[model samples]
Target: MRYRFESELRRWEARLRDDWYFVDLPPEASAEIHEWADALPRAGFGAVKVVARVGGTSWSTSIFPSASGVYSLVVGARVRRAEGVEPGEVITAEVELV
Candidate 1:
């Protein structure tokens, strides 16, 4: 299944900047995350990570999902540049476990 959500990149980054970034995901989004984690195992998910661009500096979260069935979201690398979001502000992401 595909999952999509919109959040401020700066806000998200701010949360992640610390060890415990509370996302406070909604019910639908949380369900999607669980589903994606379940599906990742079958999709050959060998790695999981977050790709964020901040102030022209590209950085990614620590790799996750070295195994399957452990995804967190549906943000991927194909997302286009959106308005109001700087290159580094990670908003409306498309992450895949693999």
Candidate 2:
């Protein structure tokens, strides 16, 4: 399955050391992901494997379940730099389930 949407790039940190950015998938996409995950073998953390595209850059990653009760895609520093994306800026993402 393929899903596409626009979302705000949100910043977060882990253990106050690693800074990360992610975009939350819309509720409709999350619902589809739930069904997709159910029919596939689970990965760690319920991550759904995908190939994500942002701007002109595309990379392999996974959509992770978020505390917000949805799925979110991590936009790595390399990807952010390649795409010239900034936190709080809206970005359109294309995710292909793998």
Instruction: Specify the highest-TM-score model's number.
Output: 2
lDDT at 76, model 1: 30
Cα lDDT of model 1 by residue, 1-98, tens digit: 33344543322253465432211223564455555554444433443344543234343442233123333332233322323344334455433233
Give the per-residue Cα lDDT of candidate 2 at 55: 86
Model 1, residue 89: distance off in Å is 6.6
Write model 2 residue lDDT over 23-82, tens digit each, in one string: 999999998788779776456998988999998899988889887778999999999999
Clashes of each: 11, 0
Q: TM-score per candidate, in order?
A: 0.31, 0.91
What local lDDT does model 2 show for residue 44? 92
How good is model 1 by TM-score? 0.31
Off by over 4 Å in 1: 11-26, 42-90, 96-98
